[model samples]
Target: MFKIKSEVGFDMAHYLCGYEGKCANIHGHRYRLVATLKSETLQESGQCRGMVDDFTNFKKALKEIAEDFDHKLLIEDNEEGRELAAKLEVLPNNFDIVFVPYRTTAEEMSRDVFNRLKSKGFKIYEVELFETPTNSCIYTEE
Candidate 1:
């Protein structure tokens, strides 16, 4: 099998609702994500022969996903999330919010992004999400 991967990084802030510790408070991280794709076949050409696939297309998709979350608040769905966002909205100006269908954890985000790429008919092998420089997680369907 042939594999190709791409990565992107961004900044985000989030708080875990209903948590028992300091995690309940708002915090931020410089996040990075890596997406891998696999294929067993490649186009036969003068410059592209025997390659997995065109890495340019994979990079484009990764860029699109990264742009969606850069410099945004990664909010999870909960009473706290709603209330805090409401308060922020009432400030002098407004900030953009990125809401996940589930908690704003690396695991959930990884799975969500993986599904999104897969739904687009991409040969997604895995998604790796780095919530911190030392902490990261991966999600794969197969």
Candidate 2:
């Protein structure tokens, strides 16, 4: 089996709704997102003659997706958080609201990104999401 990986870093802010601690409040983090691709065969000849996969296109697409979330607020399903996000969406703040289908955690974030990228026709095998420098989560699709 051959595998290739690409990594991109971005920053975003968010507060978990219904949390009992400081995480319930608004906060931000310099997030890191890593994407991995795998394939069993390599092209015999072409621009990627010797590579397991062409990462240039992959990286470019991933970067574009990351750009949308960069410097945005990632709010989960908290009423207060949604209210604040709604109000902020109309303000001068260039806040981007991402309505996640799951809880706002590193784990969920990775899975979300993984599914999105896959839906976009990228051969995504694994996703690593970093919520903090000391904490990160990974999700893989088998």
Candidate 2, residues 58-86, lDDT tens digits: the string is 89877987897798778775677678778
The prediction achieving the highest TM-score against the true structure is: 1
lDDT of each: 0.84, 0.81
Error of 1 at 20 (Å): 2.5
| Highest-lDDT candidate | 1
Error of 2 at 99 (Å): 2.6
RMSD in angstroms, candidate 1? 2.0
In the range 1-142, model 1's lDDT, one tens digit per residue, is: 8788989998888767677787877788898999998888876886657776567877888888888888888787778788888988898766788777688889988998899889877889999999988999999978
